[model samples]
Target: MLDAVADLLLEAGYDGLTIDAVAARSGVHRTTVYRRWRDTGGLLADALDAAREVPWEPPDTGSLAGDLTEINRQIVAALTEEPSITAALIAASFRSPAAAAALRSFWEDRYAIAAIVVERVAPGVPARPVLLASCAPVFYELVLLRGPAPGDELAERYARLAAASVSRSGAAP
Candidate 1:
Protein backbone atom coordinates (compact mmCIF):
# COMPACT_ATOMS: atom_id res chain seq x y z
CA MET A 1 0.00 0.00 0.00
CA LEU A 2 2.78 2.45 0.94
CA ASP A 3 4.74 1.60 -2.18
CA ALA A 4 1.63 2.11 -4.24
CA VAL A 5 1.09 5.53 -2.74
CA ALA A 6 4.71 6.56 -3.32
CA ASP A 7 4.59 5.41 -6.93
CA LEU A 8 1.45 7.42 -7.59
CA LEU A 9 3.06 10.54 -6.24
CA LEU A 10 6.25 9.93 -8.18
CA GLU A 11 4.43 9.37 -11.41
CA ALA A 12 1.75 12.01 -11.12
CA GLY A 13 3.00 14.55 -8.58
CA TYR A 14 1.08 15.61 -5.48
CA ASP A 15 -1.99 17.04 -7.13
CA GLY A 16 -2.71 13.87 -9.02
CA LEU A 17 -2.13 11.67 -6.01
CA THR A 18 -5.52 10.90 -4.50
CA ILE A 19 -6.27 8.40 -1.77
CA ASP A 20 -8.88 6.93 -4.05
CA ALA A 21 -6.28 6.56 -6.78
CA VAL A 22 -3.93 4.78 -4.39
CA ALA A 23 -6.63 2.47 -3.22
CA ALA A 24 -7.67 1.69 -6.75
CA ARG A 25 -4.11 1.14 -7.90
CA SER A 26 -3.17 -1.05 -4.96
CA GLY A 27 -6.39 -3.07 -5.01
CA VAL A 28 -7.02 -2.14 -1.40
CA HIS A 29 -10.43 -0.83 -0.43
CA ARG A 30 -10.63 2.95 -0.18
CA THR A 31 -11.89 2.75 3.37
CA THR A 32 -8.91 0.65 4.40
CA VAL A 33 -6.48 3.16 2.93
CA TYR A 34 -8.30 6.00 4.64
CA ARG A 35 -8.38 4.19 7.95
CA ARG A 36 -4.64 3.53 7.88
CA TRP A 37 -3.37 6.85 6.50
CA ARG A 38 -6.07 9.38 7.49
CA ASP A 39 -4.92 11.74 4.70
CA THR A 40 -2.53 12.13 1.81
CA GLY A 41 0.08 13.74 4.03
CA GLY A 42 0.09 10.87 6.49
CA LEU A 43 0.19 8.31 3.71
CA LEU A 44 3.12 10.01 1.98
CA ALA A 45 5.05 10.45 5.23
CA ASP A 46 4.84 6.80 6.06
CA ALA A 47 5.89 5.86 2.55
CA LEU A 48 8.92 8.14 2.79
CA ASP A 49 9.88 6.59 6.12
CA ALA A 50 9.44 3.10 4.77
CA ALA A 51 11.70 3.65 1.78
CA ARG A 52 15.30 2.50 1.84
CA GLU A 53 17.81 4.34 4.00
CA VAL A 54 20.76 6.05 2.39
CA PRO A 55 23.97 4.60 3.72
CA TRP A 56 26.64 6.77 5.33
CA GLU A 57 30.25 5.95 4.65
CA PRO A 58 33.05 8.38 5.44
CA PRO A 59 36.12 7.78 3.32
CA ASP A 60 39.32 8.28 5.29
CA THR A 61 41.24 9.21 2.10
CA GLY A 62 44.23 10.12 4.35
CA SER A 63 43.55 13.83 3.69
CA LEU A 64 40.59 15.99 4.59
CA ALA A 65 40.35 17.58 1.14
CA GLY A 66 40.05 14.25 -0.62
CA ASP A 67 37.52 12.92 1.83
CA LEU A 68 35.30 16.01 1.63
CA THR A 69 35.42 16.04 -2.15
CA GLU A 70 34.38 12.42 -2.33
CA ILE A 71 31.62 12.91 0.20
CA ASN A 72 30.11 15.93 -1.55
CA ARG A 73 30.33 14.22 -4.91
CA GLN A 74 28.39 11.24 -3.65
CA ILE A 75 25.85 13.46 -1.87
CA VAL A 76 25.12 15.43 -5.03
CA ALA A 77 24.70 12.28 -7.04
CA ALA A 78 22.37 10.85 -4.45
CA LEU A 79 20.15 13.94 -4.45
CA THR A 80 19.96 14.02 -8.22
CA GLU A 81 18.91 10.40 -8.38
CA GLU A 82 16.42 10.75 -5.54
CA PRO A 83 12.79 10.05 -6.49
CA SER A 84 10.87 12.94 -8.04
CA ILE A 85 8.03 12.34 -5.62
CA THR A 86 10.39 13.62 -2.97
CA ALA A 87 10.12 17.10 -4.42
CA ALA A 88 6.35 16.88 -4.32
CA LEU A 89 6.57 15.62 -0.78
CA ILE A 90 8.81 18.57 0.13
CA ALA A 91 6.37 21.02 -1.40
CA ALA A 92 3.53 19.36 0.46
CA SER A 93 5.49 19.76 3.66
CA PHE A 94 4.87 23.50 3.63
CA ARG A 95 1.14 22.97 4.16
CA SER A 96 1.23 19.92 6.41
CA PRO A 97 2.96 19.58 9.77
CA ALA A 98 3.16 15.82 9.38
CA ALA A 99 4.97 16.20 6.08
CA ALA A 100 7.31 18.77 7.57
CA ALA A 101 8.26 16.49 10.43
CA ALA A 102 8.77 13.63 8.03
CA LEU A 103 11.00 15.77 5.85
CA ARG A 104 13.12 16.62 8.89
CA SER A 105 13.47 12.97 9.75
CA PHE A 106 14.68 12.16 6.23
CA TRP A 107 17.16 15.03 6.25
CA GLU A 108 18.47 14.10 9.69
CA ASP A 109 20.18 11.03 8.26
CA ARG A 110 22.03 13.09 5.67
CA TYR A 111 23.07 15.58 8.34
CA ALA A 112 24.41 12.81 10.51
CA ILE A 113 26.66 11.69 7.65
CA ALA A 114 27.74 15.30 7.10
CA ALA A 115 28.56 15.64 10.79
CA ILE A 116 30.81 12.64 10.77
CA VAL A 117 32.76 14.00 7.81
CA VAL A 118 33.07 17.40 9.44
CA GLU A 119 34.32 15.86 12.68
CA ARG A 120 36.96 13.92 10.84
CA VAL A 121 37.96 16.83 8.64
CA ALA A 122 37.76 19.74 11.03
CA PRO A 123 37.50 18.39 14.54
CA GLY A 124 36.52 21.53 16.42
CA VAL A 125 34.65 23.37 13.72
CA PRO A 126 30.91 23.74 14.24
CA ALA A 127 29.30 21.01 12.14
CA ARG A 128 25.93 22.46 11.20
CA PRO A 129 26.67 25.68 9.30
CA VAL A 130 29.90 24.58 7.72
CA LEU A 131 28.43 21.37 6.45
CA LEU A 132 25.32 23.18 5.29
CA ALA A 133 27.32 25.71 3.31
CA SER A 134 29.60 23.08 1.89
CA CYS A 135 26.70 21.31 0.23
CA ALA A 136 24.62 24.42 -0.41
CA PRO A 137 26.53 25.51 -3.51
CA VAL A 138 25.64 22.38 -5.46
CA PHE A 139 21.98 22.52 -4.43
CA TYR A 140 21.86 26.22 -5.16
CA GLU A 141 23.34 25.73 -8.57
CA LEU A 142 21.09 22.87 -9.50
CA VAL A 143 17.82 23.72 -7.77
CA LEU A 144 17.35 27.27 -6.48
CA LEU A 145 19.79 29.08 -8.72
CA ARG A 146 18.66 27.06 -11.77
CA GLY A 147 22.21 26.77 -12.97
CA PRO A 148 23.97 23.73 -14.33
CA ALA A 149 24.31 20.79 -12.00
CA PRO A 150 27.78 20.31 -10.65
CA GLY A 151 29.46 17.33 -12.21
CA ASP A 152 32.17 15.31 -10.50
CA GLU A 153 34.91 17.69 -11.59
CA LEU A 154 33.10 20.74 -10.29
CA ALA A 155 32.09 19.02 -7.10
CA GLU A 156 35.69 18.14 -6.48
CA ARG A 157 36.74 21.67 -7.27
CA TYR A 158 34.27 23.15 -4.83
CA ALA A 159 35.17 20.64 -2.17
CA ARG A 160 38.88 21.28 -2.65
CA LEU A 161 38.35 25.01 -2.46
CA ALA A 162 36.36 24.58 0.72
CA ALA A 163 39.02 22.31 2.14
CA ALA A 164 41.74 24.87 1.32
CA SER A 165 39.78 27.67 2.94
CA VAL A 166 39.15 25.56 6.03
CA SER A 167 42.72 24.30 6.20
CA ARG A 168 44.09 27.86 6.16
CA SER A 169 42.09 28.37 9.34
CA GLY A 170 44.21 25.46 10.70
CA ALA A 171 41.38 22.99 11.10
CA ALA A 172 41.26 19.93 8.75
CA PRO A 173 44.78 18.85 8.01
Candidate 2:
Protein backbone atom coordinates (compact mmCIF):
# COMPACT_ATOMS: atom_id res chain seq x y z
CA MET A 1 0.00 0.00 0.00
CA LEU A 2 2.84 2.39 0.79
CA ASP A 3 4.52 1.45 -2.47
CA ALA A 4 1.25 2.17 -4.23
CA VAL A 5 1.07 5.56 -2.59
CA ALA A 6 4.63 6.40 -3.69
CA ASP A 7 3.84 5.42 -7.24
CA LEU A 8 0.58 7.34 -7.23
CA LEU A 9 2.28 10.38 -5.71
CA LEU A 10 4.87 10.29 -8.48
CA GLU A 11 2.15 9.96 -11.12
CA ALA A 12 -0.19 12.57 -9.63
CA GLY A 13 0.55 15.46 -7.35
CA TYR A 14 -0.79 15.55 -3.81
CA ASP A 15 -4.03 17.19 -4.97
CA GLY A 16 -4.72 14.38 -7.38
CA LEU A 17 -3.91 11.47 -5.08
CA THR A 18 -7.00 9.72 -3.79
CA ILE A 19 -7.73 6.90 -1.40
CA ASP A 20 -9.49 5.07 -4.17
CA ALA A 21 -6.42 5.33 -6.39
CA VAL A 22 -4.17 3.89 -3.70
CA ALA A 23 -6.58 1.09 -2.92
CA ALA A 24 -6.94 0.19 -6.58
CA ARG A 25 -3.21 0.25 -7.12
CA SER A 26 -2.48 -1.80 -4.03
CA GLY A 27 -5.42 -4.15 -4.63
CA VAL A 28 -6.47 -3.46 -1.09
CA HIS A 29 -10.06 -2.79 -0.13
CA ARG A 30 -11.04 0.85 0.25
CA THR A 31 -12.37 0.14 3.70
CA THR A 32 -9.07 -1.43 4.70
CA VAL A 33 -7.08 1.56 3.57
CA TYR A 34 -9.47 3.90 5.28
CA ARG A 35 -9.30 1.89 8.48
CA ARG A 36 -5.52 1.84 8.41
CA TRP A 37 -4.78 5.38 7.29
CA ARG A 38 -7.93 7.36 8.24
CA ASP A 39 -7.51 10.00 5.49
CA THR A 40 -5.49 11.02 2.48
CA GLY A 41 -3.06 13.09 4.53
CA GLY A 42 -2.59 10.27 6.98
CA LEU A 43 -2.04 7.87 4.12
CA LEU A 44 0.53 10.12 2.52
CA ALA A 45 2.29 10.65 5.81
CA ASP A 46 2.42 6.95 6.50
CA ALA A 47 3.63 6.23 2.99
CA LEU A 48 6.43 8.75 3.42
CA ASP A 49 7.18 7.36 6.85
CA ALA A 50 7.32 3.88 5.41
CA ALA A 51 9.61 4.99 2.62
CA ARG A 52 11.93 6.66 5.11
CA GLU A 53 12.31 3.46 7.08
CA VAL A 54 14.75 2.30 4.46
CA PRO A 55 17.79 3.49 6.29
CA TRP A 56 20.50 5.53 4.57
CA GLU A 57 23.62 4.55 6.43
CA PRO A 58 26.42 7.07 6.44
CA PRO A 59 29.65 6.04 4.81
CA ASP A 60 32.59 5.05 6.99
CA THR A 61 35.35 6.07 4.61
CA GLY A 62 37.73 6.89 7.53
CA SER A 63 37.73 10.56 6.56
CA LEU A 64 34.95 13.11 7.12
CA ALA A 65 35.44 14.49 3.63
CA GLY A 66 34.86 11.13 2.03
CA ASP A 67 31.77 10.43 4.13
CA LEU A 68 30.28 13.86 3.49
CA THR A 69 31.01 13.68 -0.21
CA GLU A 70 29.19 10.34 -0.41
CA ILE A 71 26.25 11.83 1.46
CA ASN A 72 26.12 14.79 -0.92
CA ARG A 73 26.26 12.45 -3.87
CA GLN A 74 23.27 10.58 -2.52
CA ILE A 75 21.39 13.85 -2.01
CA VAL A 76 22.11 14.93 -5.58
CA ALA A 77 20.92 11.61 -6.93
CA ALA A 78 17.68 11.77 -4.97
CA LEU A 79 16.90 15.36 -5.90
CA THR A 80 17.82 14.88 -9.53
CA GLU A 81 16.54 11.39 -10.26
CA GLU A 82 13.18 11.88 -8.59
CA PRO A 83 12.53 15.52 -9.21
CA SER A 84 8.77 15.16 -9.70
CA ILE A 85 8.26 13.05 -6.60
CA THR A 86 10.51 15.29 -4.53
CA ALA A 87 8.74 18.42 -5.77
CA ALA A 88 5.34 16.95 -5.08
CA LEU A 89 6.33 16.03 -1.56
CA ILE A 90 7.82 19.46 -0.93
CA ALA A 91 4.69 21.18 -2.22
CA ALA A 92 2.42 18.93 -0.22
CA SER A 93 4.49 19.56 2.91
CA PHE A 94 3.84 23.29 2.72
CA ARG A 95 0.09 22.85 2.41
CA SER A 96 -0.58 19.85 4.63
CA PRO A 97 0.20 19.86 8.33
CA ALA A 98 0.47 16.10 8.37
CA ALA A 99 2.93 16.18 5.50
CA ALA A 100 4.94 18.96 7.09
CA ALA A 101 5.21 17.05 10.34
CA ALA A 102 6.11 13.88 8.52
CA LEU A 103 8.75 15.64 6.48
CA ARG A 104 10.23 17.14 9.63
CA SER A 105 10.36 13.76 11.28
CA PHE A 106 11.96 12.28 8.19
CA TRP A 107 14.74 14.85 8.15
CA GLU A 108 15.29 14.64 11.88
CA ASP A 109 15.69 10.91 11.70
CA ARG A 110 17.96 11.01 8.68
CA TYR A 111 20.11 13.74 10.21
CA ALA A 112 20.48 11.85 13.43
CA ILE A 113 21.82 8.90 11.50
CA ALA A 114 24.08 10.97 9.29
CA ALA A 115 25.35 13.13 12.13
CA ILE A 116 27.46 10.23 13.31
CA VAL A 117 29.87 10.89 10.48
CA VAL A 118 30.35 14.48 11.58
CA GLU A 119 30.60 13.52 15.22
CA ARG A 120 33.23 10.93 14.47
CA VAL A 121 35.39 13.50 12.73
CA ALA A 122 34.70 16.59 14.79
CA PRO A 123 33.96 15.37 18.28
CA GLY A 124 32.94 18.66 19.90
CA VAL A 125 31.65 20.59 16.92
CA PRO A 126 27.99 20.98 16.03
CA ALA A 127 27.24 18.68 13.14
CA ARG A 128 24.18 20.27 11.55
CA PRO A 129 25.83 23.31 9.96
CA VAL A 130 28.75 21.31 8.73
CA LEU A 131 26.43 18.80 7.09
CA LEU A 132 24.24 21.57 5.71
CA ALA A 133 27.22 23.41 4.27
CA SER A 134 28.16 20.32 2.33
CA CYS A 135 24.83 20.06 0.56
CA ALA A 136 23.29 23.55 0.65
CA PRO A 137 24.91 24.73 -2.56
CA VAL A 138 23.50 21.84 -4.52
CA PHE A 139 20.07 22.52 -3.06
CA TYR A 140 20.38 26.21 -3.79
CA GLU A 141 21.29 25.56 -7.38
CA LEU A 142 18.64 22.95 -7.95
CA VAL A 143 15.73 24.40 -5.97
CA LEU A 144 16.28 28.14 -5.89
CA LEU A 145 18.11 28.75 -9.14
CA ARG A 146 16.22 26.05 -11.07
CA GLY A 147 19.50 25.13 -12.68
CA PRO A 148 21.01 21.87 -13.73
CA ALA A 149 21.63 19.33 -11.00
CA PRO A 150 25.19 19.32 -9.69
CA GLY A 151 27.31 16.31 -10.40
CA ASP A 152 29.57 14.31 -8.04
CA GLU A 153 32.57 16.56 -8.61
CA LEU A 154 30.69 19.52 -7.16
CA ALA A 155 29.55 17.41 -4.25
CA GLU A 156 33.11 16.34 -3.56
CA ARG A 157 34.34 19.90 -3.68
CA TYR A 158 31.67 21.08 -1.27
CA ALA A 159 32.43 18.22 1.08
CA ARG A 160 36.14 18.93 1.00
CA LEU A 161 35.59 22.62 1.66
CA ALA A 162 33.15 21.92 4.49
CA ALA A 163 35.48 19.39 6.07
CA ALA A 164 38.43 21.72 5.84
CA SER A 165 36.47 24.61 7.36
CA VAL A 166 35.23 22.56 10.30
CA SER A 167 38.56 20.85 10.88
CA ARG A 168 40.50 24.09 10.85
CA SER A 169 38.17 26.22 12.95
CA GLY A 170 36.35 23.64 15.08
CA ALA A 171 33.25 25.62 14.20
CA ALA A 172 30.14 24.89 12.21
CA PRO A 173 29.83 26.56 8.84
Candidate 3:
Protein backbone atom coordinates (compact mmCIF):
# COMPACT_ATOMS: atom_id res chain seq x y z
CA MET A 1 0.00 0.00 0.00
CA LEU A 2 1.13 3.53 -0.72
CA ASP A 3 0.55 4.50 2.89
CA ALA A 4 3.04 1.84 3.96
CA VAL A 5 5.44 2.98 1.29
CA ALA A 6 5.32 6.59 2.50
CA ASP A 7 5.83 5.56 6.09
CA LEU A 8 8.69 3.22 5.34
CA LEU A 9 10.30 5.69 2.97
CA LEU A 10 10.15 8.36 5.61
CA GLU A 11 11.50 6.03 8.29
CA ALA A 12 14.41 4.60 6.36
CA GLY A 13 15.05 6.93 3.44
CA TYR A 14 15.35 5.77 -0.16
CA ASP A 15 18.14 3.32 0.65
CA GLY A 16 16.01 1.49 3.20
CA LEU A 17 12.77 1.27 1.22
CA THR A 18 12.29 -2.31 0.09
CA ILE A 19 9.54 -4.56 -1.22
CA ASP A 20 9.77 -6.76 1.86
CA ALA A 21 9.44 -3.86 4.26
CA VAL A 22 6.45 -2.45 2.42
CA ALA A 23 4.85 -5.87 2.28
CA ALA A 24 5.33 -6.37 6.00
CA ARG A 25 4.10 -2.94 6.81
CA SER A 26 1.03 -3.20 4.59
CA GLY A 27 0.45 -6.94 5.15
CA VAL A 28 0.22 -7.21 1.37
CA HIS A 29 2.83 -9.95 0.89
CA ARG A 30 6.20 -9.34 -0.64
CA THR A 31 5.32 -11.23 -3.81
CA THR A 32 2.26 -9.09 -4.42
CA VAL A 33 4.18 -5.93 -3.72
CA TYR A 34 6.97 -6.99 -6.02
CA ARG A 35 4.57 -8.00 -8.77
CA ARG A 36 2.72 -4.72 -8.59
CA TRP A 37 5.66 -2.41 -8.02
CA ARG A 38 9.05 -3.81 -8.87
CA ASP A 39 11.19 -1.50 -6.75
CA THR A 40 11.30 1.45 -4.40
CA GLY A 41 11.17 3.90 -7.26
CA GLY A 42 8.02 2.26 -8.60
CA LEU A 43 6.41 2.48 -5.20
CA LEU A 44 7.40 6.13 -4.86
CA ALA A 45 6.13 6.99 -8.32
CA ASP A 46 2.87 5.17 -7.62
CA ALA A 47 2.46 7.10 -4.39
CA LEU A 48 2.95 10.40 -6.19
CA ASP A 49 0.46 9.29 -8.86
CA ALA A 50 -2.09 8.54 -6.17
CA ALA A 51 -1.42 11.88 -4.50
CA ARG A 52 -2.05 13.69 -7.79
CA GLU A 53 -5.68 12.50 -7.75
CA VAL A 54 -6.51 14.07 -4.39
CA PRO A 55 -8.96 16.94 -4.83
CA TRP A 56 -7.37 20.38 -4.71
CA GLU A 57 -8.46 23.87 -5.62
CA PRO A 58 -6.40 27.05 -5.60
CA PRO A 59 -7.41 29.72 -3.13
CA ASP A 60 -10.07 32.13 -4.41
CA THR A 61 -10.05 35.24 -2.25
CA GLY A 62 -11.52 37.76 -4.76
CA SER A 63 -8.09 39.31 -5.38
CA LEU A 64 -4.78 38.14 -6.85
CA ALA A 65 -2.75 39.17 -3.80
CA GLY A 66 -5.05 37.37 -1.41
CA ASP A 67 -5.06 34.19 -3.46
CA LEU A 68 -1.29 34.18 -3.93
CA THR A 69 -0.68 34.95 -0.26
CA GLU A 70 -2.90 32.07 0.78
CA ILE A 71 -1.05 29.80 -1.63
CA ASN A 72 2.31 30.81 -0.16
CA ARG A 73 1.05 30.13 3.34
CA GLN A 74 -0.03 26.67 2.26
CA ILE A 75 3.44 26.09 0.85
CA VAL A 76 5.01 27.15 4.12
CA ALA A 77 2.82 24.77 6.05
CA ALA A 78 3.50 21.84 3.75
CA LEU A 79 7.20 22.38 4.02
CA THR A 80 7.22 22.83 7.78
CA GLU A 81 4.51 20.47 9.02
CA GLU A 82 5.37 17.50 11.25
CA PRO A 83 6.06 14.30 9.37
CA SER A 84 6.12 16.49 6.31
CA ILE A 85 5.21 14.34 3.32
CA THR A 86 6.05 17.16 0.92
CA ALA A 87 9.55 17.31 2.32
CA ALA A 88 9.93 13.54 2.21
CA LEU A 89 8.78 13.26 -1.38
CA ILE A 90 11.01 16.14 -2.37
CA ALA A 91 13.96 14.30 -0.91
CA ALA A 92 13.02 11.06 -2.61
CA SER A 93 12.82 12.77 -5.97
CA PHE A 94 16.53 13.51 -5.85
CA ARG A 95 17.40 9.88 -5.13
CA SER A 96 15.12 8.22 -7.64
CA PRO A 97 14.60 9.09 -11.28
CA ALA A 98 11.09 7.63 -11.19
CA ALA A 99 10.24 9.74 -8.20
CA ALA A 100 11.70 12.79 -9.93
CA ALA A 101 9.47 12.22 -12.94
CA ALA A 102 6.45 11.55 -10.79
CA LEU A 103 7.07 14.67 -8.72
CA ARG A 104 7.32 16.69 -11.93
CA SER A 105 3.99 15.29 -13.09
CA PHE A 106 2.40 16.01 -9.74
CA TRP A 107 3.52 19.66 -9.86
CA GLU A 108 2.34 20.03 -13.44
CA ASP A 109 -1.13 18.95 -12.42
CA ARG A 110 -1.02 21.28 -9.43
CA TYR A 111 -0.02 24.27 -11.56
CA ALA A 112 -2.76 23.50 -14.07
CA ILE A 113 -5.37 23.61 -11.32
CA ALA A 114 -3.83 26.73 -9.81
CA ALA A 115 -3.92 28.42 -13.21
CA ILE A 116 -7.59 29.23 -12.76
CA VAL A 117 -6.65 31.80 -10.15
CA VAL A 118 -4.42 33.57 -12.65
CA GLU A 119 -6.97 33.28 -15.46
CA ARG A 120 -9.51 35.16 -13.34
CA VAL A 121 -7.03 38.01 -12.88
CA ALA A 122 -5.49 38.19 -16.34
CA PRO A 123 -7.23 36.47 -19.20
CA GLY A 124 -4.34 36.46 -21.65
CA VAL A 125 -1.29 36.19 -19.39
CA PRO A 126 0.48 32.90 -18.91
CA ALA A 127 -0.17 31.47 -15.45
CA ARG A 128 2.79 29.11 -15.01
CA PRO A 129 5.57 31.66 -14.58
CA VAL A 130 3.38 33.97 -12.59
CA LEU A 131 2.50 31.13 -10.27
CA LEU A 132 6.24 30.39 -9.97
CA ALA A 133 6.98 33.99 -9.16
CA SER A 134 4.38 33.88 -6.43
CA CYS A 135 5.49 30.58 -4.93
CA ALA A 136 9.23 30.26 -5.59
CA PRO A 137 10.47 32.37 -2.69
CA VAL A 138 8.69 30.18 -0.18
CA PHE A 139 10.51 27.11 -1.43
CA TYR A 140 13.79 28.88 -1.96
CA GLU A 141 13.78 30.22 1.56
CA LEU A 142 12.63 27.04 3.25
CA VAL A 143 14.33 24.36 1.16
CA LEU A 144 17.38 25.87 -0.44
CA LEU A 145 18.44 28.76 1.74
CA ARG A 146 17.31 27.09 4.99
CA GLY A 147 15.81 30.35 6.21
CA PRO A 148 12.87 30.75 8.52
CA ALA A 149 9.48 31.01 6.87
CA PRO A 150 8.63 34.53 5.69
CA GLY A 151 5.31 34.29 7.58
CA ASP A 152 1.94 35.75 6.55
CA GLU A 153 2.91 39.40 6.24
CA LEU A 154 5.91 38.59 4.09
CA ALA A 155 3.83 36.09 2.18
CA GLU A 156 1.28 38.81 1.51
CA ARG A 157 4.07 41.22 0.61
CA TYR A 158 5.48 38.71 -1.86
CA ALA A 159 2.03 38.33 -3.33
CA ARG A 160 1.71 42.09 -3.62
CA LEU A 161 5.08 42.32 -5.30
CA ALA A 162 4.22 39.59 -7.80
CA ALA A 163 0.82 41.09 -8.50
CA ALA A 164 2.34 44.50 -9.04
CA SER A 165 4.87 43.11 -11.52
CA VAL A 166 2.11 41.47 -13.53
CA SER A 167 -0.18 44.49 -13.27
CA ARG A 168 2.54 46.73 -14.66
CA SER A 169 3.02 44.32 -17.53
CA GLY A 170 -0.59 44.77 -18.78
CA ALA A 171 -2.51 42.40 -16.50
CA ALA A 172 -5.72 43.68 -14.94
CA PRO A 173 -5.28 46.17 -12.14
Off by over 4 Å in 3: none
Runs in model 2 lying further than 4 Å from the true structure: 82-84, 170-173
In candidate 1, position 103 carries an lDDT of 81
Choose the strongest candidate by lDDT: 3
- Candidate 1: stretches off by over 4 Å: 52-55, 82-85
Evaluated at residue 71, the lDDT of candidate 2 is: 88
Arrange candidates by lDDT, highest first: which order?
A: 3, 2, 1
Q: In candidate 2, what are the lDDT values of residues 20-87, reduced to their tens digit?
A: 99999999999999898887789878867886878677899989899999988887777778646666
Cα lDDT for residue 77, candidate 2: 77
| lDDT per residue (tens digit) for residues 1-173 in model 1 | 87787788777777767899999999999999999988888987887677526455667777766776777786567556657565567667777778778888876666676677667768898766666666667666655665555578756776777677777888756
Q: Which candidate ranks first by TM-score, i.e. highest?
A: 3
lDDT at residue 72 of model 3 (Cα atoms): 87
What's the C-alpha lDDT at position 28 in model 3? 95
**TM-score of model 1 relative to the true fold?**
0.81
Per-candidate TM-score against the hidden true structure: 0.81, 0.87, 0.94
Greater TM-score among 1 and 3 belongs to 3
Model 1 lDDT on a 0 to 1 scale? 0.72
